[model samples]
Target: MTITRRNLGLLGAAGAAMLAMPSVVRAQAPRVVRYTHFQPGRLDQPKHAAALAFKSTLEGLTGGRMRVDIFPAGQIGPAPQVMEQLRLGSLEMAVVHDGGISGTYAPYQVFSLPFIWENQAIAWKVLDGAFGAEMAEDMRRRANIRLLGHADNGVRHFTNSKRPIVTPDDMRGLKIRVQPAPVFVKLVESLGASPSAIDWGELPAALAQGTVDGQENGVTNILAASLYQHQKHITLNGHVYSLHAYLMSDRFFNRLGNEEKAAVLQATEIAKVIHRGMTTAQDANAEPILKEKGMTVQRLTAPQIDAFRQKAQPAVRSWLEAEIGREWVEKLLSATRAATAG
Candidate 1:
């Protein structure tokens, strides 16, 4: 309670000691990132592969000042919940599919317009260009989530236990499981299949239990979830060029230091490349992969694919225009056309 010369001297000495150990005084706890994805944490899974690359590259870039903790296969929660966590900054990052994103940013469903992309190359060009940048900015503003980059979810194709879908007519009367997105629902309906809105996690079970006769997904997902075990046939319709969005919480990102931010952005781009490459390879070899899995694989000719496009494209596009507005619909159409032309 009394000021003493001895106490004053001791306090001064402590201050001097602290000053002498600058590194100890200046050291801060590492920033932790809680990253998540829907796929299992296996090297074979594109999402997990990309996630590992991201974690290593980011930590290395930041000299361990930043740490990433990955939660794969919905360990944190389901897609909708995970997305909400990201938006609220409770989760730092996610590599979410387009269907998962649609619940948060409805306009993202514009990408669900069937058969728009001629090939993965055309899709990549549009996603890596101004159109993608614009969409990212808009998503940041609307959802409080930053879209770092886009990767392939795979070019979606139809698989069924009932029949090989060679034409739109062949799709009739079968119940197909689709992501719980309106565009996908409309797409299946347009092809004359009865669509059952099923969660991705429930898809294999749905097919196995005969809750749905078939479902559509990319080759990467089919193998990742082993849906091929349930579905007997796959048609290489390539109906939709699906996407996996590299997303970060804007709240978390905005608080980062300049150098940390740079590292994250660069690391995300690297992950995006890995994710895209792995998924694209699987999609390119869909027939062989599905056949190896002991499923019947049907490869469509150009005319057959065109028939699918004619049937489903307009229906899905119309639904998208109605839900998200024609502006985004047209924007995607124009972007794809430009990408194809180039």
Candidate 2:
């Protein structure tokens, strides 16, 4: 074989061209966020708003190198199934309710304490405070995921096929649907009511068939699910300040570079603002919408709410101190107090 200078020169040009290319070209494949939510997508749905923001902000911040495949209306199984997928690294992200987290992340149940936060402002103050950061760190330490941020969910209220609920005794003899969490079970049990456990996806049909008299959900959820059609009255117990957790699997988060990780985290922080704004802004119009549906809305006085909370809180507080650490509970209360003072 004869060696040729021209062939050698061509090979040298090819090597130089290869060296000019980037070592790691921006990831073009869709990042695939198997995100899930329990709400149907509509013009006014807050979860949808948040999900869209998650998709947009994440993709936008990454310059379209990353993409999210959102699953709304329980398209990717139910909330529990999605969380399990998250644990196994099959799913990338989710904004689940604390009740859903209670199954795997027990500390998250702290947010589900019945009749806790006085209003949205108080809830936001505490959730966005230093204590909230501590709780988020705890989840990362124990639960194999990073706490992204919190999305807003209005107060959990009671709606039943029966009459108005003015007191805890009024909840008696009713088989109300509660979350699968123990706190919810205890909360309903404290009222002498038969607590029925059901997932959100199945609640509507159950209510329609009388399998359950009613379910506790935020006013936004009640209106979204059109639960008014099944139940005659809505008692605004505001028993629990509903919470939506923004979560990211540590498995995925750990794989990213420092700047990419910061982008994801910062995006989540801004999402909390979008989440709260979307929810609180919607509250003023929710009551009128509920009334127009012909379902009566019950607003209890401060004394009435205090009466129920006094009984319910002790059970919840005792249960928490036993299940989670007393120190953690104290921190939560301290955080609440600090936020109120501010």
Candidate 3:
């Protein structure tokens, strides 16, 4: 076959075009993040809303080069399985609670220690500062996870169908559902309640079926899960200033370029603020909402709260020290004092 100069030039151009196609396709393909959580994927839910905000900001910052796919309401699996996935690098990210991680990363249990923080002001100061950095480093070393930031789970409070729980004695004879953690079990038992270890996924059913008379959780959680429907009374005991952890796979994080890493971290901070704001707003507005839903919401005065704190704190702190160590407990107490002192 005879080839002309024009034919040869066309062939070269076609070869060059084919060679460039792969790079074009690679540039267009977005990096996907599988972000999972165990909360309702609704705008009204703080965690879910924050997840959306994170997705938007990260994508925007990356110029659509990054995309996040959110899985909420335990769609992937339970907390333990999801956390395990993150550890194994099978999952990209998650917003798990302190109780969920305490078993694997024992230091996270510090947040679960009842009556540890006097109020949210003191708690945020510690969590958003040096203590938080230390915990983040510990988590990176031990759990192979990067702590992006802390979001609110809000201060856990007591809710029951039986009666108002103003004092420790009022908790007596009540079958209280606690997280399947020794710390929580001890906390409830110390308050004179019979503690039943129930999974959060099963809690609403347990409360509805009278398998347990009541349970403890943050107002946002109770509201999100609609526990107010089953529980008649709520006491703002503010037992534990619990938090939700925003974590990324350290392996994944380390592999990212500097710009990508910055986008992820900055997106996390923005999302953290959004999450905390929603949670705090919900907490502040909870009593009225609960009342509107035909449930009795009781606000404990300083003396009332102090009385329960006096009875419960020492015992729970001792339990925590025994479970984790005296060192962590002492460090936490010192940090708490330093963070809150005038």
Model 3 TM-score (2 dp): 0.94
Question: What TM-score do all the candidates reach, one by one?
Answer: 0.94, 0.90, 0.94
Question: How do all the candidates rank in terms of lDDT, highest first?
Answer: 1, 3, 2
For candidate 3, list the clashing residue pairs, or say none. none
Q: Provide the lowest-lDDT 10-residue window in model 2.
A: 22-31
Cα-based lDDT at residue 179, candidate 3: 85
What is the C-alpha lDDT profile of model 1 across 1-342, one tens digit per residue?
997999999999999888878766456668999999999899999999999999999999999999999999989888899889889999899888999899999889988988888888898899999999999999999999999999999999899987777989999999999999888989999999899999988888888888989999999999998998899999998998899999999999999999999999999989988998999889888888889999998999999999988888888877888899999988888998888888
Candidate order by TM-score, highest to lowest? 1, 3, 2
lDDT of candidate 2 over 126-209, digit per residue (tens): 887788888888888777777878877777888899889989888889999987888899888887889988888778899999
Q: Candidate 1 or 3, higher lDDT? A: 1
Candidate 2 similarity to native, TM-score: 0.90
lDDT of each: 0.91, 0.80, 0.88
| Candidate of highest lDDT | 1
* Pairs that clash in candidate 2: 115-239
